[model samples]
Target: MELTFASYNIHKAVGLDGRRDPDRIMSVLREVDADIIALQEADRRFGARASVLPRALLDDTRWRPLPVAKRPRSLGWHGNALLVRRDIKCLHAEPLDLPTLEPRGAVLAELDLRGEHIRVLGAHLDLSGLRRRDQIKAILKQCTRRGKMPTVIMGDFNQWGRLTGAMQVFGMGWQQITPGASYPSARPIARFDRIIATPDWSYETSGVHHSATSAAASDHLPVWASLRTA
Candidate 1:
């Protein structure tokens, strides 16, 4: 089986022009066109955490969002959302807790694709390196508790330099697909987004989704990967 996965931080639907347009964000997502997409900053930072993207817009697509919203107006937990293709069956969905100075978390979704079980996690890490490490540790611990499967952990990692030793938490088996510079979409010089899969899977192709629309949609461009499972 081959799966196309993507991770994007929409910056709460605020474009480079300082406009909050959900329709424009939808257009960017349409361009991504992945089987599964992990989104960060899907909700507003204050108030009820209202979703930046309208429900009607999402319903128009072939994608179905995981229900991890705590408030009626919110779309996700800590502004993180997981969206899977409508054809994919969701077996389970939950939010993962992380240690952070600000409101930060991840969403875990166990999906069934033609009877194959796969775990997908989406997260947005803290800007501080130290907090990011602690959050990653917590995520790794959750993976340990879930046992094993074809798992993928992806989202805005906020790590600019090399992955280094911290990524070893996924064990030597996991493969990291380091997509090219995705930050500051206009003139990307940092790879702040990432996608990693367990040893059981291999990425046939991966890269940053850069386009004029994408660059205007948010500060961080989306990263994507094509995974092959035999």
Candidate 2:
């Protein structure tokens, strides 16, 4: 069976209303219909006026939690989340810290799907070019340490079509599957979001969801790809 996954910067699920809306975000995700999703900017809380995603969002299902860095009042549960169907079993979840002044990390998880072991890593890198370079290095180091398996890394890379640090990731043997421009939800012009996979995977189809439904949801449009796992 083919494995489908997606990566999106939910902007803490904040809509134009300026309130954290995980419910609406859930609806957007349900429309995407991907088995696994890697979300960035998933905030918990810090103080008043902070964004927090309620744990009850995925309460009805078997979606497990694997959180990473936690500030006093804010935290990103898992940096990236692995929401699998009933057939997928999570073996482990690993967190990798990237070089950033802000609280940023990656979520690495091992899952058992249809008798196959899949290694998936999700992360949201820094916005600055310099910091993004460091974050890419950190991600590569962790991938190397994790051993070679069919791996998938997806999230907001903050890369604006430059062939430097972010390009280095493609050279590391991960196929970058994005439209090359995604930002400002209304009129996207930067490829800040992505979904990449190892050579063991082949890109089947990819595109940017730029419908009216998505434009009003967040500042960035969600990018998705369907990969044929080898």
- Scored by lDDT, the top model is 1
Q: Tens digits of per-residue lDDT for model 2 on 1-230?
A: 58678777878787756766777777777677777777777664334423345667666544544543344333344344545565578877766777888766787888888788888777888767788778878887887887877888888888777556655756856787775566888778888788878888877888787766677677888888888877
Query: Where is model 1 more than 4 Å wrong at Cα?
Result: none
Query: Residue pairs in steric clash, candidate 1?
Result: none
What C-alpha lDDT values do all the predictions have?
0.89, 0.71
Against the true structure, what is every candidate's RMSD?
1.2, 2.8
TM-score of each: 0.96, 0.87
Scored by lDDT, model 1 comes in at 0.89
Clashes of each: 0, 5
Positional deviation of 58 in candidate 1, in angstroms? 0.5
